[model samples]
Target chain A: MDTFVQQLINGLTIGSIYALIALGYTMVYGILRLINFAHGDIYMVGAYAGLFLATSLGFAANPSAFGFVVTLVGSMAIAAAMGMAIERFAYRPVRKFSKMTTLITAIGMSLLIEYLFVFFFEGKPRSFPQLLPNDNITLFGNATISTSQILIFVVSMVLMVILQYIIYKTKIGKAMRAVSFNLNSAKLMGINTDFVIAFTFALGSALAAAGGVLTAQYNPKIDPLMGIITGLKAFVAAVLGGIGNIPGAVLGGLLIGAAETMVVGYGSYIGIPSTYRDAVAFAILILVLLLRPAGLLGSNVQEKV
Target chain B: MNWVKSIIVGIIAIAILYVLNAAMSATGFFGIGIDDYQSRLLVFIAINVILATSLNLINGFTGQFSIGHAGFMAVGAYASAYFTVTHGKAIETSLSGLGETVASSIVLLLAIGIGALVAAIAGLIVGIPSLRLKGDYLAIVTLGFAEIIRIVILNIDAVGGATGYQVPGYANFLWIGIFAIITVVVIHNIVKSDAGRALISIREDELAAEAMGVNVTRYKVTSFVIGSAFAGVSGVLFAHYNKFLSTNDFQFIKSFEIIIMIVIGGMGSMTGAILGAIIVTLLPEILRLLPAIQIGETTFQFADLRLVIFALILILTMILRPQGILGTTEFTDFFKRFRRADKPTGGLE
Candidate 1:
């Protein structure tokens, strides 16, 4: 029972990271309908920026929790700017083009960003120094949780609440909602559609950056290629929870995380080794796509035909 | 006058390439037997040309974004490798207590056929569901399917799994060249056919094409199957030439490389596919020389930054020319004056 609870906690912690990343995917898809393949790389950039800020500035040796927050915020800010730049330079020119062209361009941009990171930071995985307590505290008989996991869960929940409020109550949120419904109509209504789209990218990218920082803290070791899998998995999460729906992304992320852990934990008995855990997400994606093209929470907006 | 000039130019270009191949081989440049390597590189370029051009049939001409080309390649590679190893002349002779040298003459075309068949089957499975989706959704699903196929292949121990499989090398420059010529000819014929026109119609507007009596789903599936089958054939060539196959070799990165070739060359044109394939394949080799230059206490090697620099180039190309280098134009189309001189006056411009 304790082991199960512990696993659940770990799953949720990981799921929280996925949820944050999935939010970016869902938001972009909701409005622009582009998958923004580079979103994952933006998260990677965020982690690296945090890593540079923490290590190069000597925050690693005697880091406080407050100092970690400062580094994270600054890194996310940089990532947000990067995301905006990508939108303007790589995506904007192809805005009026066919979705195929834009999709290919997005992929090219994803590759460019990944390779840029690879060039700057060698391909070797770098370790981030522990910024949280390593010691675990027992809750029940043996249901123990680490400080980092608790922090991740707490931060994730807090961010979700803040995001919920921003999306629901804010003026920009209203404009975003209007844009998601109809871009042409919203533009005629005096909404700055371009600014909203850029803000969406920046905001989504910033959330992903937070996820990246938290993931780095949890795993401690990261490389340029790390974002590819994380991005892919989050994409799956976005699809599973009914893309373009915020709450659905969270649910999808948790479900996927739990499913992945369970597969790794139990798949050994079925002759499928734990090493194939990476593939479970992809298989699930194919299955979901085949069975339910619209996804769990996605609405079917019919063609006028 | 134009025909004579065109033939002369073509002969000169081939002569130049041949001379360069010989000179590079004689000089031992780049330490990899440049002559042999260049010939081999040219063959690989042809194989890539075949794969990229075929993919363009679906992605560029038919207007579907299927990113599982490598999965089809894997299907073809393993299928061809299995057939050649199990039923080829060398294997049959060795099993009958005959020397490997005695069985060299009998060629096995079945390997290529089987490879393409298997790839087509895989394509059918992937395409059925994908026909319902479009754009990013389709891209994600195909990407997922490719990864799933790779992982499944890696876990299936019978096919050698993570350790990889090795087959007898049977491919040569002449055979590859012949296959390349066949690919170009076949695809060229297809592109000029009524079926090709239907595909172009779908690319322009799927709904309108459907209304105009074109079976949208059927055309899409046919394009996908044929494209994937060609990719499989390319894989078979690669497996035979390399004499080894691994699941890693058919990963998403390779699929991206092939896609880049199509995107850079001009998505819909066969000649553009070939042009793109050759340049994309050769650019990395060219970039290898860039690393020898030292920069401020740290030496940048092409091996380290090749992908990054290459990806940047891809981005720039897309930004500047999203339609690609040739933009659906054939090599002959560039020289309109010469072609116009021979054509009927006041024809379709």
Candidate 2:
């Protein structure tokens, strides 16, 4: 029972990260109907931004909870700016082109970001500076949680709550919904669809940035290529939750996180090595795509003939 | 007659390239006259050409967004690497000197065939499930599938596991050149055939093609298998050329690079693929000659900034010319406009 609880804690910790990243994917897909392949790199960029700011601003010179907030907020702001810039420069011009073209451009953008980081920083993984002092607290029996894990869960929840409030209770959120439902109709109704799209990118990127910094706290290792697999898993999570649905992204993230942890903890009895844990997310993606293309919570839409 | 024409076209194309290489790199018919860097670049160009042209079949012609092509390449490279390391050794030793070269060459061809076959099987499995998906969804699935392949390769110890494998070298410019020609010719022939039309129609509109009895699933699978087979052939060439095989070599980035090649060349044009291949292969090497600067005690290398420059070029190119350099047209099509004054508006549509 303790083992189960321990596994659950671990799963939720990572699952929250996946959820945070998936929100970005889901939101972007909601508006543009694009799988922004570069969104994951934005997450990486966010983490790097946080690292740079934390180190350069002397925040990491001494460990304190106040410094952590500064790092987190700084990363989010920088990532949001990056997200908006990407949409304005890379995506807007190709918005009127083929979906295939936009998709390729997204991929190109992903490569560009990844390689640019690699070019400047080299490929070695850097140990992220700790902004907050860490300690472990036992919950009950052997199931204990670290301060970093607690930070991940609590921060992600707060962000999600804030996001929900924004999406549900704000004028811009309503405008976003209108634009997603019908771009031309929204424009005709005098809403700035372009600005709404950019806003969605900003919101999504900020979440991904949060995920990035949060994960860095837990893992403390940052690399340029770190986003590829995590981003992919988040994509799977979004799909699992029923893509384009906000609540669904969170649901998918937690479930995938739980599934992956369980597979790692207990899969050996079934002759599966823990090394194959990386594959679990993709396997789930394939299964979800085949079994429920619209995802668990997604309503099935008829294919246009 | 078409086969004959294709063979002629292949020979002419290879001959032209051979002369060009002779002048550019001195890697003509025989001898080790060419510098190592130039030869490596030339061989890589041939390999990239194979990858891009084959990818165009599924991506450009059939309009299936497959980003897991590196998965098939990994399958081919590993399979052939295993074969050459195990069976090829015996063939190499059974003959003497020049006879050994002849025997190994034949054995290498057989090994490449096996590699292609295995990769084709993998492609069939991937393509079947993936045929139902399209566009962005398809790209993600293919990518997921490729990552799975990489993980599996990493686990299996026989092919060296994560440590990687080193196989004997058997590839030269001539061999890669031959296979590249074959890939281009065979794919070009298929693209021009009646089946090719069915494939293209599916790309244009799957429902309409199915309504017209094009058997969309079958042709999609077929194009995938053929393209995968050639990717395998390129893998075989890559494995033997580099004489080393590692799962790291076939990462998702490789697939993206191949996509960029076709995208830059013009997705739907063969000549564009070739042009794209040459540019992508040579760009890094060409950039390596950039001047290095000294800042106090530090020597900053402008050469190290090539990938950054390369990426900027891709973003800028996409923004400026999203249709690619050729824009779905061909090189010969341009000259043909002048040759025939009466039929001016016609080109490969």
Clash pairs, model 2 backbone: none
Off by over 4 Å in 2: B1-3, B14-32, B93-98, B294-299, B341-349
DockQ of 1: 0.61
Shift in Å, residue B267, candidate 1: 1.0
**Model 2 Cα lDDT, one tens digit per residue, B1-349:** 5668878988998887676566545554465466767778888999999999999999989999999889999999999889998888777777546686698798789889989999999999999998789888889999999899999999989999989899888887778888889899999899988898888899889899999988888999999999999999999999999988889899988888888889888888889999999988888777777777888887767667666665666777778888789977877777864675676452545
- The second chain of candidate 2 has a TM-score of 0.91
Q: Ten consecutive residues with minimal summed lDDT in candidate 2 chain B?
A: B23-32
Using DockQ as the measure, which candidate wins?
2
Find the 10 residues in a row with the least total lDDT in model 2 chain A: A296-305
Q: Model 2 Cα displacement at A201 (Å)? A: 0.8
What is candidate 1's CAPRI-style docking category based on DockQ? medium
lDDT of 2: 0.90
**Lowest-lDDT window of 10 residues in candidate 1 chain B?**
B99-108
| Model 2 docking tier (incorrect/acceptable/medium/high) | medium
